[model samples]
Target: MSSSSEEIRLAAGTAEVGVQPGNGCRLGSLTVDGVELLRQGERYGSFPMVPWCGRTRDGRFRNGGTLHQLPVNSPPHAIHGTARDAAWKTARQSPTEAVFTYDLTDPWPYPGRVTQVVELTEDALTLRMAIETYGDSFPAQAGWHPWFNRHLAGGDGGQDDSGVQLSFTPAWQEQRGDDHLPTGTRVAPTPAPWDDCFGMPGGVDVTLTWPGRLELNVASREEWVVVYDEPADAVCVEPQTGPPNGLNTLPRLVTPLEPLETSTTWTWRRL
Candidate 1:
């Protein structure tokens, strides 16, 4: 709703998204019915989707029986991959398109380089991040952490009514732990204070409908959705390839993502 400055604006129907490139990635701002969907009040910046949100014990990981140390960015843990703090090179750009590339062959803590492109189209916004291994090693896990405000979706902002209502298919419901991690085992009942990831069947649409016909739907290519409902005035309907911290658990849980391999596409559209 603010004056378009340096941000690239994409328009389709009545929906619009503004994109900015920096910090190794592209950040998007979506608006519908004159309300902003993504949380702009918080610091808005492009962040990488690697090294995960947390680190292994002691910031060390045993890769092929060798120990590697990653710099601790989040006090006791490494946060949000290496690109969150790394500068991304803008390879291509226009009024509505941008491509950012990051080479981490030796400078990065890991042994891979990534090229992420953020494209803004009329109907939706797409971010495609590709990680290619420089050597034989592979990446552990990767994902995007974009914040959204429910108030923009039509929440009344009343004391009791100003919350988000997430609509999922019958088979998607599952429980999670306190750290917002899934327990693998399924629960028959959906618990209160729910903060977990559900299996999002591909092509299944999940909608966040607000009061005034303002809604956002994510059609997943993967099979899961990470629902993060904080005590704040927003909800994060993240489309992830696996659950949070799935890389650091017993039996290894989800398979460790390999190089030249990509997670599924997470696409969002305003309705």
Candidate 2:
């Protein structure tokens, strides 16, 4: 399944990862020793959020009782999902690991299938995603988004005080309303240029320090994690599995033998 772009490199010892199985199964970069934890182009690395993961309010959604219109493409709201922009299908690769596949046709009326795997070890970097359905029961969400790199690469000179340093302990904050979605009320974790949506519920752990150069540790068993650092260069840790219209508030259904999975793991060191 070509179409155009194709890169899939994965190393282990010095830790490198760049998989783009034609863009939707994106990553593009995640170096380690040479230090570049993501963020390098085409809107920056790490991308996957199948079936629906962010925004869909003005774009509409309502599976069982009808009402489905989506295509706002972030106009008033309809961001992220649609498999990053389609075109994925490698199904398997080697070196350090890879796998991509997509098949949820036409403006997305259901009849799903999405899989994305990425694995690089020796310091860790793992991502897995899944959503399956072929009949009935279908409402979904899955996540990943990662756009790290605020000045990675042995910092101390990249400025902005050497950039990257984000901690996480969220158990609240999701109150965003005013069209940016997420007003189910639950506030309290402020301080940053934060775009909002947090409620780790003990899942999605984050850390990304880069003071002496690297720290990275962004786990995720998924419980919603969207930390958009207001972008001065990059910082987007988005674990997501709901929160942002959440397909009309939080719907996760995907039946047809239970198929909805999520995973995120990015371990690191060297600081």
Reference-based TM-score of each model: 0.73, 0.36
In terms of TM-score, the best-performing candidate is 1
Which segments of model 2 are wrong by more than 4 Å? 1-29, 39-47, 51-62, 65-90, 94-98, 101-112, 117-132, 141-143, 155-160, 164-181, 184-192, 197-227, 230-234, 237-243, 249-271
TM-score of 1: 0.73
Residue-level lDDT tens digits of model 1 in 102-136: 66643355566666666555556666666666555
What C-alpha lDDT, on a 0 to 100 scale, does residue 6 get in candidate 2?
76
Error of 1 at 244 (Å): 2.2
Q: What is the clash count for each candidate, in the order shown?
A: 4, 0
What's model 1's lDDT at 18? 61
Q: What does the lDDT read for residue 8 in candidate 2? A: 82
RMSD of each: 5.4, 13.7
Number of the top lDDT candidate: 2
lDDT of 2 at 233: 83
